[model samples]
Target: MSRTSVPPRRARTALLAAGALVLAGLGAVSVMQSPASAAGLQCSVGYSVNDWGGGFTANVSVTNAGTTAIDGWALTYAYSGNQTLTSGWSANWTQSGKNVTVTNLDWNKTLAPGGSTSFGGNFNYSGTNTAPTAFAVNGTPCNGGTSTGSPTPTPTDSTSPSPSPSTSTPPATGDLVDNPYVGAGVYVDPEWSAKAAAEPSGTKISNQPTAVWLDRIAAINGANGSMGLRAHLDEAVKQAAGKPLVVQLVIYDLPGRDCSALASNGELGPTDIDRYEHEYIDPIATILSDPAYKDLRIVNTIEPDSLPNLVTNVSPRPTATPACDVMKANGNYVTGVGYALAHLGGVGNVYNYLDAGHHGWIGWDDNFAPTAQLMHQAATTSGATVDDVQGVIANTANYGATTEPYFTIDDTVNGTSVRQSKWVDWNRYVDEQTYAQAFRTAMVTAGFNSSVGALIDTSRNGWGGANRPTGPAAKTTLDGYVDGSRTDRRFHLGNWCNQSGAGIGERPKAAPAVGIDAYVWVKPPGQSDGASSAIANDEGKGFDRMCDPTYTGNVRNGNSMSGALPNAPLAGHWFSAQFQELLKNAYPAL
Candidate 1:
C-alpha cells in the first residue's frame, strides 16, 4: 500500500453486506536487522520488509529492553526513502512525510522487560526501500539489540491488561468461565482503531472492541500487510496481560459462501468443500490451538448468512436465488459450517457461536422453525454436537434494532395487527432482542443445551438522531404505527448494505439480559457493506445492487429503495462518509 492508497474495510467483516467471520495466518519472515533500546522507556525495534517490486510489506517487532515494565508506548521511525503507508495492523500506523508513528494498541501497549510485541504496515514507493537508521519508543532513542531469551515479551494470556484494569470486571485465570467477557478485556483492533482515529470525531469509539474479520484465506495470513490469525492471537495474549481477555474472530469463508448475495462473495467456489476444510478451517483451528493462546478466551462467530440462506433463499421462496438453489442442492453450506464448528470447537479456549439470521430474515413463521432445524442439523453433523456450540448470534452486521420500545407484534391499531404493518411485514418478531430470545428458546427446543447463550450484534441498529421517533408511531394507520414507532430507520427490513442515517447501536457489554451473553459490535461501524456500483478488484467480492443506493428493489428488500449510502467501497473497506454519519448519530450520543 502506498501513502495514497485507501484503507482496507471489513465492518461486519463477513456478516450482512457480504462476508462473516473468517480467519487467516501470516507467516513470519526472518530478516537481518539491528534492534534498539536497553533501559528506561527504550525499546529495540526490528523492521522486516517483504517487498514486491512496486509495493512492500514491513513488520516491526518492538522488544522492551527496559528493567521496569514499559507500559503504554509509541514507536516512531523515519523512512529513509519515499515510503507511503497504505494500511497496517497489530498497531495503529500513521505517517507524516517521511516519519511514521506506531502506537501500541490496547493489547500490545504493555511490554515487560525483555519482551517484544510486533506491528506491520503496507507501503508503496518508486525507488530503493532503505530501512530507517534509527527508532525510538516513548520519545527515548532506541538502542541496537536483538530479541534474545526475553521472558516478558511473549507472556501467556495470564498477563494483566494494560491502561488500567476495570474494577467492575471479575478477575480470571487461564481457564473457561461462564461468560468469558464477564471480567475480561476484549481486543481493540489496532487496525480499525487507526482508521477510526483518522476520522474527525473518530476517537469517540475508536478504542471500542469489535470483531476482527478473517473473511478470506488471504486475510487469514494478512490483509493490507499485517495481522494474520497467528498475529491477532499473539496480540490477544499480550493484551490479556494476566487477565481474562476475549478475542472475537469471525469464522466466515465457507465453500460457495454467501450464495444469496454478491457483495461479500468468497474465494471458494460452490463445491470447494475440501479446500474450505483443509486450507481454511483446519489451519485456523490449528492456530487457535497453539498452546501460547491457551489462556485467552477466543470467541469464534461461525459462518453468518450461511445456514439461514439455506432455509430462506432456496426453492419455493420468492426471495430465492438460483445460486442459493445451487448451494442448497450441493449441500456445502451445511457441511462447511458443520466442519468449521467441529474443528474450531475442539480448541480448548475457543467458544463457538453460530450466526442466526436477523429478525427481518428469519422471524417469519414459515422460516423460523425450519431454520432452527437447519442450525440443529449443522450443529449435530460432521462430528459436531450441541456441546461444541456455546450459543448463536443474531442480526450480525445487520441494521436490526435490539428492541422496539413503542410497539409489539401483538399490538393492534384499528384492529390491524402490528405484523400487518409494511415494516413488520408478517414477521412474528418486532426487533432483534425479542427475535434472539425467542430464537434461543427455539434453539433449546431444537436440541441446544438449555444454558446456550445468544449474542446480538447491536452495531449500526440504534437509528438514533433528530429523526428518531419520540414514541409509538401515530396509530391512525397500522403501517404508520409500525413505521413511526420503530427505532430501525431502514427503508425496508431487508436493507443490509450501507444504509443512510444508520448509527452506532448499544456499546458492547456482557450478560446484558437473560439468555443474551452479550451485546456486540460484530460488524464494526464505518465499513461498507459493498460497493455502491460495480467495481472490479481481486478480492473475490462482487457488486450487489443492494449496495447501490440508486438501485431499485430486490425481493429481499420488498422492492423498496436500496436504502444504501452513496459511494461506498467494497465490503470490509473503510467507508469514511458512513463512519462520519455513524458518529453524528451514535445512540446515547457521543
Candidate 2:
C-alpha cells in the first residue's frame, strides 16, 4: 500500500487535539481517482475541494490510457463560464477566463506506460458548469466533439470509435508491507518516555497513536480494581490529542486453575487470576468493542507462553501427575483462547499473533509442528478455525543470552543464573535473522506453510550476527536444522521501548524483506516487574553498562550506540551524528 500523505497544513497544537476527526472528515472528499478502464490504458480525473469554509482546495488524479509508456504530456481545454483556477499540483495549472492549460510537474514528467498520477488545484467558482471542450493530449485533439454552449453535451453517436481497453498489469499485493507503522505501545510512563526518546526525526511520539496494555495500565496507579484506570488511560491517550494514533490490547485474564484453561501465569494463583480476568481483561475487551476502535490491531494472547510451556515443561515436571486420569488436558486452554479472541469485539485495527516459543527452547523432534496442529484442533473443536488465529510469535525473555534458562524459580536463592533446562537446545543463541528463518522453516517443515509462520524479538540482539561462533562448526550445527522455511509469514521485530538506533539490522532480501515487521516495542522497555532490583540489574541505567540515566549513543571500543533515545533532547545530537556515519554503508541511489 502506498503511504498516504499527512494533512496539508495545520498547527501542532490543533493537530494533536483534533487530527483524528479532521483526517476522518477529510475522507469524505473525493481524493481517490482510477482509470476509466482496467484492461489497456485509461485516464480519468477526480476532484475534491477542501474549503476551509471559504475557498476550496481542488485535488485531481490523472491516469494513463495506453499500454506503452509516454515520457511527457500536457492537458488543455477551454473553461467557458465562471471557473477560475488559483493553484494546482502534479501539474501546473494556468487559466484565463474561458481557456485553461495544465503542464506536468517536473518530478511527474513521465507517465509510465500504464501508470497514473494525480494533481490538485484551488478554484473559486460561483456555480457548476458544462464540462470543458477541446480536450487534447500533447497538442493532439481528442476525437470527442467540441461543445459550443454552457452545458457540456455528451458526444453521442459520433463517428470516432471509443478507445480500446487497457492491457497494462497491476502491482503485487504484498506491497502493502510498505505502509509505515503509525502506532506505539505504552505500558508505563518511563516506558513511554524511553519510546518517545527513541523515535526518528520528522516523527513525533506525541503525535503517533498509542495503545496502553491493560495489564500495565492496572499495575501503574496502585489500583486494586481493573476499571480504576479506564478514565485515566482514556485521558492520557487523548493527551497526545488526535494524530491518527490508536490503542492495542491483550486480554490475559481467564478463570479456572487449569494451566491450559486461561490467564494462568505460573506466578499467579488460580482464584485471583480468575477475578482479574473477569474484572480487568473482560471490561477492556468491551472498551475495544466500541466502533471507535474498529481499526485496532492486537495480539490477543489469553496467556502468552501458554502453549509451549504448558505442553513441554509445566505439564511434565513439578506438577507430577499420579496417573493418566489425573493428568490435565490441553483442550480447555486452547479452546478457551480461541473463544476469547473471536468474542473480544469492539477493538479497532487489531490482529492477533499467538505465541510460538524461541527456536532454542524446544527440540527438533519435540513436535513443534504438532503444537500448531493441536492449537488448530482446539480452536476448531471450540468452533474456531485457523482463520481466527492470525499467526504465532517466538519469544525469548529472561533467558536472554543464557542457555539453561526457562525458570528463575529461585531469584532469592541466586538471581540471574538459576533456571532449569527442559530441552537439548539453548534458548539464547539465535540472532534475529537466524531465529526468524528458524521458525519460518520449522513451521513449513511441520506443514504449517498454509497455517503458521514466525516473528522474532530484536529487543536484545544489537550485534550484527548471532553471538554464537560461526565457521564450519556453525554450518554443521545448522546442517539438519531448518533455517529458511516460513519466508511467506510476517517477520516483525519485537523490541521493547524501542530506541531509534538500537536493534537496527540489515534489511531482509525477500521482495518485502523483514527488518521490523511492526517495530513493536512489545516489552515496553522501562517498566520493571518487581522481580529484579535496580541495583542488581539496574533497569534505570538503560543500555549496556554505560551507567547513564538514559541510554544514548556513545562510543565503546570503536562501537557506537547512537540515536537510542529519540525524545532525549541532549541525546538527539549524538544520535544524529552516528546515523550519518551509519548511512555511509547504505545503498547508493542510482
In terms of lDDT, the poorest run of 10 residues in model 1 is: 12-21
Task: Report lDDT (Cα) of residue 27, candidate 1.
Answer: 30
Tens digit of per-residue lDDT, candidate 2, span 1-590: 22123111111110010000111132321112223333343444333233332234433344455676657767666655576675443366888767777877655678775465544455556655433434555654432223233322233224532110010001111111121233433233333444445645312232322234444323322234333223434443554354433233434433332232111222233333323333333334434432333332334434454555445544344322222112224234554465554434212233455656555434334545656555555445433444444445554221122111222222111222112221112233233434444454554454332333344432223322222222112122231111121110111221122233222222211112342234233433232212111232211121222222243322211122322323222210123333322222211100
Q: Provide TM-scores for the models.
A: 0.72, 0.40
Q: After superposition, how far is residue 223 of candidate 2 from its true place, in Å?
A: 3.4
Candidate 1 Cα deviation (angstroms), residue 214? 0.9
Candidate 2 shows a clash count of: 46
What is the C-alpha local distance difference test score of each model?
0.76, 0.35
lDDT of 1: 0.76
Error of 2 at 139 (Å): 75
